[model samples]
Target chain A: MYSKELLKGTIEIIILKLLVENGSMYGYEITQQVKNLTKGKIVISEGALYPTLHKLEAIGVLSTEIIHIGRRQRKYYHVSEVGKDISALKMQELSSFLHSLNQILDFKLSS
Target chain B: MYSKELLKGTIEIIILKLLVENGSMYGYEITQQVKNLTKGKIVISEGALYPTLHKLEAIGVLSTEIIHIGRRQRKYYHVSEVGKDISALKMQELSSFLHSLNQILDFKLSS
Candidate 1:
């Protein structure tokens, strides 16, 4: 697993992007999806996951629905229109950052 | 400027790698090198730079030399043996992360 510090800046963006792309997901599902997608290299603990979800919800970037199944409540999250916009900007920013990083690390950064 | 959050995980490794590759650099030089390499998209302020250098020095991943030019004292930093090993691991981890992220965001992660 990568350090929490390394993962901190990205969790929110990853969650936002996944929700925007996948339509809707519960917290546990998001964690599972991230794990599965990253092939277990990146694990999202519940401790780090819910707070980000809540923050996104608080900021009007996400909307949630609670479903009751067998006396257990599972909250499902979806990105709002605002979230879609934010996700696009975030994806662009991440891409740009990573591209700059790639040049610095793997290619010639000096023109 | 990219958010500090996005840059937090990267600065230390970037500094270490640059110092390893370029021999040694002072704090201000590291900041300016990052700016020039990223084409001003990513800026590392002195406030963010020194503490990280100090932390690396404290951890023995870096060694510092004080060079006196006129009345001014400049501290130049170089990566130690341990830092080179650490830099390799960090670079690999970061590459793995960005690869997984690329798959998730730009390709199919459902395979």
Candidate 2:
């Protein structure tokens, strides 16, 4: 399981990347996808997930569609073309961070 | 300059990493370091920088000290030991992101 404190930054990237891979999905579906992919290791609470999703959508990185599914209206989020481009850069930025992290971790482990 | 929309997630990592490199610094210093390091390409505004700093400190990743400098007191933030470890992980996480980003960008460019 990821640390809640650390997870705030990670969640946004996961949301964007998931939308890039999946055409569109609603909040519950996104929540489930994360849970299932992590083998239930990461359980996303509604409080943390919804606000981040809402903020991302508000910022135009994601576009939402309201669809009637069964007895209720569900909002599905899809990545905008701009979101895809940003995702690409975000992915690169993360890789850079990982390299630095590994170096620091290894150095610490050795010392 | 980076996109404000894309910057929210990035700023946290930048703040942590800067603290890791430089022992302790205040809000203005953090902003200046970012600007100077980027050769003024990236300017961190008061709105974005202070909130993130406070949030990180609140989360225990950063510990702040109020030093009397000049005519007033300035709060200087240093990474907690935990923050350093997290920073290391964050660096590695970013590296992983960059690799994925490069792959996506290259594929897009070629296609």
Candidate 3:
């Protein structure tokens, strides 16, 4: 497991990307997919995940739908039209930041 | 420029690596070196740089030397033995974290 510091500021983007990939996902599903995608290397805690989802919603980058799963309603999240553009920008920033980091770390570039 | 969130928690290691690479470097020199290395893509400001340097020094991950250049004296920073071990762990954590991030972002992995 990596330090919490390492995961800071990044969970939101990952959450956004997963929703885009899976079409739409509920809270638990988002957390589960993140774990599966990274092979359990990155786990999103409940404390961390909800706030990110809510923040994205507040910023209008995400929209949600309430689905009835038996008796309980699950909140499913999906990217808004704004989110696609935002995701593109955020992903670019993240990608560029990683490239800058790689240069400092002297790691060979992949993309 | 990338978001400050992206650069958070990684600056110390960069400073550590820079000192390690150069044997030792004064604060101002360190900032200049980073600017040069990242081609100004990553600029370490004095506010951000000094605190990180001081924290590492306090943690025994860094040690300092005072040297004279003309009439002025400058404090040069270098990694301590403890720093090497810490540096190794931090670098490994950062590297692994980046890899995990790449997997999520679906970016091509380099290292």
What's each prediction's clash count? 0, 24, 0
Kindly list the per-residue Cα lDDT of model 2 for residues A16-107, writing each as its tens digit.
77788888988899888777765665566888789988987888888998999698999989988888888878766654443333332222
**Highest-DockQ candidate:** 3
> Model 1: how far is A55 from its true place, Å?
1.4
Please give, for residues B3-110, the per-residue lDDT of candidate 3 as tens digits.
888888888889988887888899999888878877888888899999988988998999999999899999999999989988988988888777777777888646
> Model 1: what is its DockQ?
0.37
Q: Give the per-residue lDDT of model 2 (tens digit) for B1-111.
A: 443444545677778877888798899988887766666656678998898899989999999999997889899999999988988887666544433333322222121
lDDT of each: 0.82, 0.69, 0.85
Worst 10 contiguous positions by lDDT, candidate 3 chain B: B102-111
**TM-scores of the candidates in the order shown:** 0.91, 0.51, 0.94
Q: Residue A3 in candidate 1 has what lDDT?
A: 59
Lowest summed lDDT across 10 adjacent residues in model 3 chain A is found at: A102-111
lDDT of 3 by residue, A1-111 (tens): 778887887988898888878788999988887788789999999999998889999999999999997999999999999898998898888877777777778875453
- The collision pairs in model 1 are none
Q: Name the weakest run of 10 consecutive residues (lDDT summed) in model 1 chain A.
A: A102-111
* TM-score of the B chain in each candidate versus the native B chain: 0.91, 0.89, 0.93
Candidate 2 chain B, run of 10 with poorest lDDT: B102-111
TM-score of 2: 0.51
